[model samples]
Target: MLMLRLVIASMASSSLSFQEKYDVFLSFRGEDTRNTFASYLYAALSAKQILTFMDHELERGDEISPTLRRAIEESKISAIIFSENYASSTWCLDELVQILECKKTREHIVIPIFYGIDPSVVRKQKGSYGVSFAELEERFRDRMEKVHQWRAALTEASNLCGLDSKDFRPENKLVQKILEDISFKLPKYLSFNEQLKGHLIGIEKHIKEIESRLSISTKDVRIIGIWGMGGTGKTTLASVVFQRLSYFQFEGYYFLWNVREEYSRYGANHLRKKLLSELLNDESILRMDTPFVASPFINDKLRRKKVLIVLDDVDSSTQLEALVEGYYHFALGSRIIVTTRNAQVLKKVADDIYKLDGLNEIESLKLLNLYAFGKSSPPKNYAMLSNNVISYADGNPLALKVLGSFLHSKSTDEWESALNKLKRIPNKDILDVLRISYEGLDKGEQNLFLDIACLINQSFTRDDAEKMLDAGDSFTKIGLTVLIEKSLIECRKDNKLWMHDLLRQVGHTIVCDEHREPGKRSRLWDVKDVCHVLERNMGTAAVEGISFNMSEISKDIKMCHASFSEMYNLRFLKIYCDNIDNKKFKLYLPQG
Candidate 1:
């Protein structure tokens, strides 16, 4: 066990140590290439938000400075532009030697761009390159060892695969090509597994199914959809497939996350421009005035490039049209994956759809144990409690994780109390995620959802709930259908209406948000709040409904006319008193 702990610590430290400070480093002769080609390249990279280090001033020395060396060591990639006078300066040669050394030592990426210079001349040390080296040899005759190292460095760098400026016609075209190459070579900045909170229980099977659906080896466009409720891990699954399939064989790749939220916040035009800019590797596309203007540009530019794109959390079909119209908008062999909570959105554009379901009981327990104990199974002493928590979570990944984390270090008694509390009040983090689908409902649907969440869940059938709600039978039926489609509620084969515990808590909380005081709230479910309102005569017009289980309360309670008089809009009230004969509970009414 001690050795296992040490191994885990070491692995974590190693992961942290591998972080790169800069995305790219620029190596060029300031006098020869800085003002023209180098400047343009730096500006383009900076506009794309690529972290780069470029020395703007000229360095006057034969040896590379410590600061420059550090930059080379910290950068993930280095771009060496070999101009006419590149080899003439000992400073440039020394920088090149350091970059190549870092490449050999750290497995860094080195891109050599022969700008208006012959690759053969640079590789063989002939022509202008030879002339510059001769001058360096004469000047550094005493340091002949250093001059030899510089010559070897240039030869090695020039031999690697690189771009030649002469092959690309216009300067802008050359810049675009370089950007595209960099995009292809750059490592993924975001890790899909990391976003999953380090738990991927039961994900491998889904990934394999998605991989078979992709059929990436075929030379045809494929659009696959992943649909599920919130917290179902749809985004995580799609991200894993994307990262695994996106290889250097593809021309380009882009992942656009939170399409629904971002589109709502920044509008469809912003998303369209961002998509074009990222896939095309050019930030200038962001200047387009509207999505209509940008669509043609995207079609013209990306139609020939085979790429992989993932659009996550899409809520509408319009977002799909604006980003990727259809097969005609992309090159053959391209693949597009869209993740959404609505199946209707996928029916319009997706050729294949994969619907995600909740985790199984065994997987749920494993996930909870991993979060609480950092292992695959709970400790022997806590096995029963773990099972109980899993039962309450009902295979929901988010709830299991939240509850496990909350009860991680608590004592046995605390665990019992926490579980009891969870039966009444849900964890805030869990409620937040479950509330997203609830917030998306219309007012009528929202009311119907609250009725199920607060009073009807697991106890009442669909017909019973419809009879209780004030909306007409047709409107109530439509609302219930919408709720079911959105995964907010489920109807069992027995015709009983059911809701996830976390979602039920969210619905109750929404009604609670009307006011902090119990009497001012639209709904009341907690015994303490109900007792306070009834005992203190705090009932008010805001109290629309009240539901409580009297058996859970130990003391007897009595309510007079004042408790019911102030509630002018009281619509429904339910009290489950199993010990009514033992406890003296009374409700008095006023004369009409």
Candidate 2:
């Protein structure tokens, strides 16, 4: 099979090097079917942006022109519309022979549409086919070999997969089937670029997990969901799997990226139209104004087709329903893969849910090293700094890539400074991407997220964090669970509340955005900012929470009672004085 594919690819590259100019070559008897079925098929293919060569001009003689022969070789597939009186034309027979030869040598696809006829009749030259062949034989009795060759070519073409107009109820239905068949056979539908071949590290394991869940060898319709945080490479892993499975002989395939964003931008109906147009290979569906109207159309057209579809970055059940609602809408062997940040969205629909985690420590380091140094290992003297960056990234691929690229060509001192600055301030590029998931949270969930990101991350247990929030017990518990389901936070086995560093940074940035000055902000963590606020009595009513690292400040630190008076809304406060003696640190609070 491998060798056969190689040979086919070589022949296609060599013979149809100009296939970009046309997708299909049409051959037919003009008087028999040109204005009828042939014209409809050509228009249908063209509506799908399929460039087809259909010769409409009157032929001067029986001999095939050089231009016609070139068109036959340049096309990726040939659609021969064999109708009554088709065999009477010697020119049509000659074109059929050339199409068959090209199919044999170049491995080009050949689809025979028996218009108002039967395959056995066309193959055996019986009935009207036989009558037309008898006339041609009598007229060309001197060129007996030519007549025999035409007969053999028709027999070969009739044996392949094709549509019979009689099998379909109406002519338009047959035209649709022909379009579907040709679109499925065309190679452009499965072409994925190879730019990420080497960059997809640690994706094979995820792909294997998905494949096992898919069980492609079985004839079951499987819907698998891959849920993970943003920048965890969910889309990357899905794309890799899509490309690998494209080699399978499925009836159709589509990889739709950024489903949530697309639906939000163009509305659900537009997305539905786009999905249907790509799957059915007909762009006319885009005219539909609402998903309610397109849903039934999709179910009717794609019900029996075995297709593979990947819906990436989906955020809601509405989006899923708008595209692919139920398993019954597709064939038995079809497979659908969906990637999302919200696990709750897949709970009711996915047959099996795979929660994608960040890369492991080793994989994270290797990825950072590759991006920073263009290799899999760090430079000789930069190992410590590299390890620091890896520790800060905490296995998040986006953070590692951003930090690595930022520190790529810097000196040791610069690396140290950047690492230190990152400890206090996260990279904006990384923060912006990670913030998307946070921004999707509701107001209550956003408050809980900020609480964890700014103050409770890693330092407090889940129960302790919930107590600090001061909301009702049930409300706080459900909010935290929602955060976990959203991939924004996780509860460790040791009962600690954990969140990705980049996500923590995002939360901190959100709080910081409320006020440029730390004293005016709702949350304050920096020691210098805290001391400045205390020493200058700059505290404000806007401050909802404040924390001071006393160990990082002077032992002679003192605060005025008036500073605490100004913080009228402060509900949460922490003072870390590990290095200083208790008596040396003085705090003055007003007596209410």
Candidate 3:
């Protein structure tokens, strides 16, 4: 078997002399699957220019060898081909030990490929394979837990789609599929093409250093925190960074969204279940009473393994504390990236802080054009309006998106009207524009949009939206499609939906108008203490349906309600303020 592997390894001689690094290291017991499976796998992988390293010579001694250990360390990814008799071999066990050690030192990625045996048997130390590991641990009883940990790693990986040796030969379609899956899992950015599409613009020197830290080998948990104001594009910056990380290049990678919102309801258990189900790509077996199932699924599987995890939109230190305990549970070379609106959040979890600055004028214009025209440049006729709109937007991407989306198909009259409304409104907050856009929508669209938007007030699911909206495809698919294209809402990679705070504020503003019951809106407000009235009576007022006058509030206070509907509501609500929010205010109120 060793000879066969050596013969195949030598076939890649064309690139061998230049000493280019090997892409994959194939490990297996020479006796069991090497001759039958590893040999074919080696040839096929090598054909694709994926380097394979396998020892050909039979050593004189039975002792573990240093040559094999070094080979395992230098390789970027180790593919351990586990067969029935794999654990019985001292040579294979030694290789396994070294592979695991290198994994701990952040030296390489390890993938345990179950060729013929069941993964759970290895993980639980069951059957013949389990017995072999047990014997090895007895010899090295002091390091018994380490031995078991390697077994657990194999089992955890096996939970992800397993390849059967009998069913999948190296050249078989299944083998190719598995190889491609592994290729995707390998460290490459989320979008290699996009990264190369054009050079990154306006990225600071420190940002590069943060990315460099991610690239370098390290044992400690590396945390990068990106902090900025509400409209400063913290999410976008973190997204670009996540794309660059090529987390799939590693053995385990996960991107978690809205950490602050989810933690509040589901607590750590829900998050653990999410990580296990989403990251592992496993079918959820979550039960409230048996949350421990999710913990063991992750802890037993990913303990001490290098993983790239992204926790986005973290608002509080408690959120971070709940999700990630410390670096100790993660394998060496693990990297975590966090994004938040709070600097204190960055200070808490981040080893280094990157304060995300607003986009430069050119970048801002480009972003606006992307939203307004779906192209990189402004149209000839719309350039003046576009420039005017951009100036009013003041370089906030969220504002640009909302404003551009509202003006996307409007005529010159509409553009002037919208722009005038935006200017007169004073608040000009992006969410305010979104609110106005919501107000401008026809009743059906407005209702559906507000339903989805308000559902995000506490961060609900699409199913929740489905139940709340109750209007079939119009509300669920078509309405969501329209909202997303309009840039009013964003669907996270995780199944949950997200409404920009601006958009949520807009939803609040739009709901506080002609659509809602006047009495309910009035009950929440007190026009006498008008400033506090507007501030405290915002979201609930929107829900109860009252549009308040924007001009009545001071400039700063108006800015707080800078959503489009709020400004539009001002046109009507300003005239009615004297009569609203009074204890004597009375109107029909919806009841359960």
Query: In candidate 2, what are the lDDT values of residues 400-459, reduced to their tens digit?
Result: 878888888889999999988987788889888888898888898998787777666376
Error of 1 at 431 (Å): 2.9
Best by TM-score: 2
Identify the runs in model 2 with alpha carbons over 4 angstroms from their true place: 1-198, 289-298, 576-592
**How well is each residue in 456-552 modelled by candidate 3, as lDDT tens digits?**
3335566656554553355566666556534456566765676654555455455455434433342223333344444443333232222333334
lDDT, candidate 2, equals 0.80
In angstroms, the error of model 3 at 546 is 23
Ranking by TM-score: 2, 1, 3
A best-first ranking of the candidates according to their lDDT comes to: 1, 2, 3
Instruction: List, residue by residue over 197-249, the lDDT tens digit for candidate 1.
Output: 43568777888899899897888888999887778788879887776666444
TM-score of each: 0.62, 0.66, 0.42
What's the lDDT for candidate 3?
A: 0.60
